[model samples]
Target: MKKEKIQLKGITWGHTRGFVPMVATAQRYEELHPEIEIVWKKRTLQEFADKSVTDLAMEYDLMVIDHPWTGHAAAQKMVIPFDDFLPETFLEDQRENSVGESYASYNFEGKQWALPIDAATPVAASRPDILQELDVLLPRTFDDLLALAQKGRVGFSLLPIDVLMSFYMFCCSSGEVPCQNDEQVVREETGVRVLKLFKSLADHIDERFYAKNPFKVFEDMTQHDEIAYCPFAYGYSNYSRQGYARKLLHFHDLVALKAGDEPMTSTLGGAGLAVSSQSKHIDVAVDYARFVASPEIQETLYVENGGQPGHLRAWKNTQVNALTANYFVNTLPALERAYLRPRYDGHLHFQDHAGDVVVHYLKNGGDERAVLAELNTMYRESLAWEGVHG
Candidate 1:
């Protein structure tokens, strides 16, 4: 005789890559453990980026979360700290093998809030067949990228969040990092240069990119014959895999900021699995999360089911690369050097509004001096939330 199975629910982003792998893994986990069953629900990718984890934790036993939320979640005690449930030995292993700062990103206020299941950053994506048809060589330097943009084939996600991230990228490449301290976001000169560069590139590419997210950009590229390359958008491994789209797109690092060196760095973006502190099924949820993130499961079942893994072993696995057209290996360097966003409890408030300031400037003409002043004001106001109550 057997007892009735336990049921658990989860929330994750809703995309073929975002939603499918978790469902597939849950099916297998249930098959192996007849005592438990897990169901996953989804919100849009933009919502995934924008939602409040404190609110989501109340509704779902498990959550797929962005790393930036750890600060607020930790402060509010809205989610279970992985360090409390997962063993130190296991944690040390995760820390040692993290793809870029994937493992560390989840650690805030000296506690681990989630298990990194996917690791990605902006990298170059191109349709070689289309580029070859147009007789344009892929770009290698910032100057080359601008030259190619002038040819009217390059496109990248120009959504506000992405524009903000691109601003950070150009700011970093210009020798000043954004939000280095609580009081400021970027140097004035660097902000001006980054905005000017973005406007210059936007001048050449189709205006439709302003509305496209990374997934949409990939979809449009596969559906049409016009765009040939994207210098930076969050990498989606599915495009590199066969039969996942209308056409396979090759993934590689970004064009260099200068001649003969590492490719330009971009903002880090990935998803992790976290257990809601409110869940009655903590043990079961933790077990499933551990199972989903283990290297063996990550390299084989997760990748096979369309997940981009956060484990370094998966990135280095030859078979994984063979299946995904070397997307992991070629883009690994960029991820390893990717820039991390600020984790202050009030950072999200800034992110939600600050991006639009840049986007507005990009689309409609605005004074660069005004934009810089606005960002600095937002930065100072956000830091005040550190001590003030809601």
Candidate 2:
């Protein structure tokens, strides 16, 4: 009699960084365990961010997820908690070495809903050769960045989602964290100040960039000499790798709001690995998840195959830093201080619409107070949803 074969299907966002490593790891895992085979698929980035975990859980054995979805996943039991499946020591190591709040972001209601496999936050990127040719120093302050934008040398992602994340960055940098209260996203005064600051910068850039995302901004930077610097974008290590693009990008921590202040806090963005509760082969899925997230694998195979690793060891690996032109070394501080977004069951509802409100205020120059009021209404409604749904 022949032995039975186990097959597991996984879904991740479509990107070289997002999709490639899973395939690499799956291939490696299959070689290590001949009886088990893993197949991976991908969806668009927007779909990855907005799609419900419950829907994906029903079809796939493994899922690459946004941390914010953990709250909903836990609430709905869409994915099994790793605490019950993975070893305690492994979980402790993940917590200690997490990039910023990456590990904690996936823990909701006292359950470990997922294991962080990748980590990122917005960081500054520049074309060093272009800057040298233009004789421009990298912008060190908010005003310097504004002046560069005024010269049409700075490119940034201004999509509603990016704008909203920047809104959080400015609010937090200015000593007021947004969405801390049930009734408001931030204090009225802080919201107004952030909006004004954001608009002043946005006013200087080309209007066409309003539709671009971070990936597009990076592509524009490397493909043309027009963009000398990008003030901030969710850092992608691929651009820093040699031969990955036409021009190599030099990445670093964000510029200060002013000359003397500390660098700003960016909103955390990364993908987590979770096993579906509906999977037929739970043990094999858990074992595969561990293999992918283990420190040795994360630092070696994962990063080598186009991954931005969640493990701190990978971030500190000298060879890994060399491979990406010190991208990990330079941006790790920003990641360490990045703001972790809310993970309540209903926070996604607020996240989905709040960006549009910020984008409107940035483009239309409305009463900042009205913007705050609208955001507050959303916040209150989100909390009410938790009450009814939680």
lDDT agreement with native, every candidate: 0.89, 0.92
Among the numbered candidates, top lDDT falls to 2
Q: List residue ranges in candidate 2 displaced over 4 A.
A: none
RMSD of 2: 1.0
Q: What is the TM-score of each candidate against the true structure?
A: 0.97, 0.98
lDDT of 1 by residue, 1-390 (tens): 878789999999998778888999999999999889899999998999888999999999999999988888888898998889988988888899999999888999789999999998889999999888888788899888888788888999989888888888888777787898766798777888888987888777788998999999999888888888999999998998889888889998888878976678788889999999999899999999999999899999998999999899999999999999999999999999898988778888788788899888878868998998999898888888766833
> Candidate 2 lDDT (Cα, whole model)?
0.92
Query: Clashes in candidate 1: how many?
Result: 0
Measured over all alpha carbons after superposition, the RMSD of each candidate to the real structure, in angstroms, is 1.3, 1.0
lDDT of 2 by residue, 1-390 (tens): 989889999999898899999999999999999999899999988888899999999999999999989989999998999999888999999999999899999998888999999999999999999889988898889998998898899989888778888889999899998888787888988888888998999888887678888888999999989999998899999999999999999999999998889998889998999999999999999999999999999999999999999999999999999999999999999999999889899988888899899888777888988988998998899999988997
